[model samples]
Target: MIQLVVSIILYFVIFFGIAFILNMLLRRTWLMAFLYPFVVLIIVDNMSTMEYLKAPGSAFSEAFSRLMQITPVDIAILVAGFAGTIVSGIIIKLLRKSGYQMF
Candidate 1:
């Protein structure tokens, strides 16, 4: 209950944090900016899968099983990561257009 809610919040925070850092670091490169987070989400998913594999029968595994489901919070995190990347890309492009360099 409360723990699940907390886990969802944590996942959202971490996912967006990673996307933001990658966005800033690769702002000058459009493809990387758009693609890096997508790849990162795959890694995150893999991590959840690994958690499942490491403990196939336990409360820990059940918690991770719920997290891996297609829940609204999970969807929101994915959307936030994607949108943040695009918004950062657009900001970088606009800055460049205005003769401001991003590095």
Candidate 2:
């Protein structure tokens, strides 16, 4: 339990820390907003996944098995990477290009 909590906190900290650094290099107005945040989240998630790889829980494995739950750690990494590389990128593009009209 404690490990889980710690992992979540660490994720937030690392994500935000990377975000802060990114902000320095590029303004929030730019920097590929949606994609950038996801990239940060993915990096953080990867770290958490490493811990879970040590010993995947039986209860979790069984419960999430239907979700293609080969391993908890694998899931985390996939989710994060998927978010960063795919979902977030698409979202960011849509959002930035959304509300406007020009001829």
Best by TM-score: 1
lDDT per model vs. reference: 0.57, 0.45
Q: Please estimate how well model 2 matches the true structure, expressed as its whole-model Cα lDDT.
A: 0.45
Writing each residue's lDDT as its tens digit, candidate 2 over 1-103 gives 6765566555445544554444444535234445654443433443455444565574335434434533575355434433333433344346558942212
| Position 11, candidate 2: lDDT | 49
For model 1, the run of ten residues with the poorest summed lDDT: 37-46
List model 1 lDDT by residue over 33-103, tens digit each. Answer: 45755464454454554654677576354554544776675566556556555665666667678998646
Q: For every candidate structure, what is the RMSD over all alpha carbons to the true structure, in angstroms?
A: 7.2, 11.3
Worst 10 residues of 2 by lDDT: 81-90
In order of appearance, the predictions have TM-scores of 0.48, 0.35
